[model samples]
Target: MCATHKAFFSYVWRKFLNMYRFSVISSFLALSCFLSLASYELPDHSNGEPTTDYSINEYWLSLFSGFSKDVDVFYVYPTSWYKLDPAEPDFCAIDHPTMLSRSKVVFDIQATAFETVGNLYAPYYRQADAAYTLSLPADKRWAVVDSIPAKDVIAAFDYYIKHYNKGKPYILVGHSQGAQVLMLLLKNYMPEHTGTYARMVCAYVIGYPVTAEFMSSNKHLKFAESAEDTGVIVSYNTQSPSVAPGANIVLGDEIGLVINPINWKRDETPATAEESLGSYMPIDAQGNPALIPHFADARINMAKGVIECSSVNETDMFNLSGKMGPEVYHSFDIPFYYYNLRENAQVRVNRFLAK
Candidate 1:
């Protein structure tokens, strides 16, 4: 918990203890507890350490805001910020001119999967620069991710639950850097927000690994064993068979639980390219944004704990790569099974609501 939130709740408790009549205090306390559970507004962003104003209209590049549905999708975009100069700050500000535009493009491409199932809420956070963040070892990478970037997302989420959610079920989705931070968000923030957690149909933490340590620590965390399992995480890192075992997104020594995007199974059973509904390929140096029907196949590489795409050529996939080797399909994790994800979300939500 942030110190500011602690202080706010403490202030509420102090006031709760001081009321004169026991019954009056009891009634008011119940209201206060309800209000607390409902939403928590963060303190003003005046402290100026890359403080993100979630209340401001510009900070959020939301695609589907006001909703007609009972569910919502909170999307965090992958690493678009690439800081080459060592002297510059390690994070991308919420208002970085090009970053905002890139976020919109990325969202339209990535977040659209859930648009049919729920309203989209994609926030502009001061996220870690891809180059700077990836250069570091795992521990340092996490430190950078846990700093200002973490705060922006947590605060944005709190604002979301505070102002928008109103008890509606929601799904969390992210790719690459966004996926890593979402993992941290689930670990650090969700424990205190169990009510909100319970309403999650599933978290599509795509293009990242969900460690067994994480599952053990957050006992509430569950890897989706089936397509229709509500309140579980659906995740898989995509790489071709040639990417080499350890070259994928699997964390060192930590077990990453993976589910095949096509079959939604945890085992090594191969789901063929023919079963793949389609892939919404992002416009790369090669081509324009286009949907290729039955683009890639998914089969779990159990030894490395990642989805190994075979049957179709990995080089044929459209994406812009930087430091990551050509074989790693980190960019295509969602796009590879865009239709499947969209369909599975509806299936899960339907199952959740049915129960």
Candidate 2:
């Protein structure tokens, strides 16, 4: 090789090696930080473990004040066994949950898959010009009320019913543990308050199951299968039929209720309505830009290729390039599945209101 070319190749080789080293280090720091955050010690609620009551209450209050449309939406977030009580004045003082073993972590990995997918439905409760709020309850606290099935969520909803919701239409959204609780509420609590059902604009219960038994036993339970803009159920799960993760599995029974995260309709193909998000006018399944919800749709432009590339085997997906710090990464990467779902949801919710 010529001397100049050899020097250039040497430099490129060195750069690649440095980049590789940086990737390894960054991933470690990022994972460590997430562990630190996820493992924070929770407070001792009256029953023992921490409670998500505070987060749920705050979210409801925020959503109530944030929107001017005069509608009510009940939102819930699932709990992780590793959840720490954010309400505790001194969250760092308590020790981490050492009782949780590696297997528990794997279980949580699968459980949180649903949690992450479920909570993404929050922005769907409002119109293009309005705002929606989300409140999440902490999970896995020792307090009887702090666990996923704890009383905080129900109590919060009851509080809203007693104080705010009278005749206005509403939406119900939840994920994982929250979805489980919401399913129960729909089956038990909402029925007693039949008026609540009449007002339900829609319910997006992701990452939780509404079993065939539940559907069969209760004539009232049904999944939304249209884009007509009415009250409906939207749910779905992510999987390649051949590459199943084997444990903490979400089976056919559980997966049956999941709707396509793309278009809200049950029968439509799970392809993006607009192939290139960064365009002037985007169209839906009908190929009409007039029907698109712009604000929510902006995400498609920003995250067009994230989901398929989410599983970066290295510690960090983005290189530090010599920057010294922990680099954290969230799931639902580029072409964020959640953002597309959020946009699709807004479009559907708006249609429901227009009618």
Candidate 3:
């Protein structure tokens, strides 16, 4: 899995750095450990207000500041079913209550994977897990949380709309399990909030799918069909034609929803595309990078179109299975994924804000 993620990284490094220096540096054990340091500290969000409790670590916020625009992006990360001991300093412990925080006016919900005890990473379970977190706070802790109820998700969104959302235009972003939650958010909330959707620049959902059902339901919610600017949905997923043994297999949401970041289209072929990094590269009509965004291309299809995890979509069968888990290979993959998704985000969001 690490190697697979690294391949995606190679593509990204090729696109931006001009040389694979980062990859070379990344190979060094000590340097890699230092890079692994949390890019951002979870903001201190002990407060109870929905908007106030959401905060981005300084490192993350610093990175976000590089954006050409001031559009606010709310990020929801996956969580494990670990308990938070307010007694502990890592207030951002894996639990319900500890997940809530007051960092910005935006609302950031943390997906709770901490409490559920099972061989997770299954298809339907991921959907259910993501749905559960979409409505919870960054710090709200729960005991023995239920893991199979989609209805809970609907109710949670209702509560969020009444409380947190209250009618504000916002950008949505997520990865992996969190991405699953974002998918449901678009289907259940975004479309219905067309007024808000219009106000929303776009959704940056990576490592997940934006299925046909979702695309067909909302005329406004289209995938990034081209490298050119787009609105509403900017989605993609990474897949390796063959992952190493013992890799983590993520199942949920069909492959249709899982798109190739490079093309922003359905996953169909392993096109041999090359990325160049140099002084003069083509820029999009919108002034964004015209070259393929780094790390945007993936080897697997994440947005397969299956509503139920157990459904008959062959894409659902695809997994990162093997001896080691996804964690081993995620570092390389995550940056590239973020690089591509953010590049598209920069374009679509600027356009959305301009409108």
Candidate 4:
């Protein structure tokens, strides 16, 4: 071979090897980056440390800072940790970043409804991950769900009552799994402590199911019949008119309570959309009420025991559809009736005080 041809071939071979090495390194680095993002886990709260100390300010999302109100509200937030790894930690530590971010959204959208009517107090409890209940079998799920989360709620409520409540009439508000915890608290805690139960202005247990069997068994608690009814429980799960009773989050065999927040009625009578005060969506970066959408009408399905909204704008961010159907508005139970809930809370508080 000629010396010039050999030199040129040698140079070409070297360039090809360099490119091959660069491509291999780049591919490995890209895979590492993707794995790091996907495997991101929440902080481990499994150290057997005491998760809450109400004496410290960090344990509370909102504490009494000398603000005065006729009544107090003790709120429990819904499922905020959706991506929590079952192997890493089942319960979210109070300072978990994702939990805090999601909880803020819940407060902004749901807890704000009661701000005008009372002194709001939301505690940072060790909430169970969203997967805890959904992943387990029906018989096994409740046992796991009610374990850690319920203890945190009960402890928080006890602390709130001892230090903050000061014998003031208070309202209990909880959504989704939070509602389930409160229901357990009502059944297990209230009976032993009659005075505390008596002091409860009302309980707004929204988004979760409250079965007829459970209500019938708990004689001390009464489902709210009218807007002004105090010392009662107001509960409902919102769905589209087309969604059937057994579909979605609501089980077919279960008979749960329902109330139309717009009209504040327990019966199936339709409340017009014009009657709806407003439905507030999530806040933007500026922390303002993002959007307020209105529906045409709302009514309780007597047989299904779920609120059936009419002429719902599916395009709205809050009016979401799921595998169950277009009627699955579980996340927007509070936002969908924001104004009506706020006003109804005040009305009930006034009636309670009058008596």
Candidate 4 per-residue C-alpha lDDT over 1-355 given as tens digits, one digit per residue, 9 for 90 to 100: 2456335434543443333221101122222222332233333333365537777778788786676897999998887664323355556677888677767767877898898989999888777654434434444445555677777788889999998889999999999778988998998899999999999989999977788888899998899888888899999888787776566543435667888898877788898777777767433323345434453367898888888776554434222234324567776678778888998999999999999
Q: What is each predicted model's overall lDDT from 0 to 1? A: 0.71, 0.38, 0.36, 0.71
Q: Which 10-residue window of candidate 3 scores lowest in summed lDDT?
A: 114-123
Error of 2 at 271 (Å): 1.0
TM-score of every model? 0.82, 0.50, 0.46, 0.81
Candidate 4: the clashing residue pairs are: 240-327, 246-252
lDDT of 2 by residue, 1-355 (tens): 3456435434543454343332112222223223344344543423453433433432331234433454455665433223123332222111123212221222222222223222211211100000000111123211222232434456566656666666666667665445556766676676687776766777766544455566676667667665445556665433322222221122211334444444433443434434322211112222222222121111111111111122221232224312222221211111224445445555555676677
lDDT string for model 1 (215-301, tens) is 888886888999999998888887778876555432434457899888988899999988988877533332235566766888997
Residue-pair clashes per prediction, in order, are 0, 15, 60, 2
The local lDDT score (0 to 100) that residue 126 gets in candidate 4 is: 76
Q: Model 3, stretches more than 4 Å misplaced? A: 1-69, 80-169, 217-220, 243-248, 263-333
lDDT of 3: 0.36
User: RMSD of each candidate?
Assistant: 17.9, 13.7, 14.1, 15.4
User: Could you tell me the lDDT of residue 120 within candidate 4?
Assistant: 92
lDDT: the better of candidates 3 and 4: 4
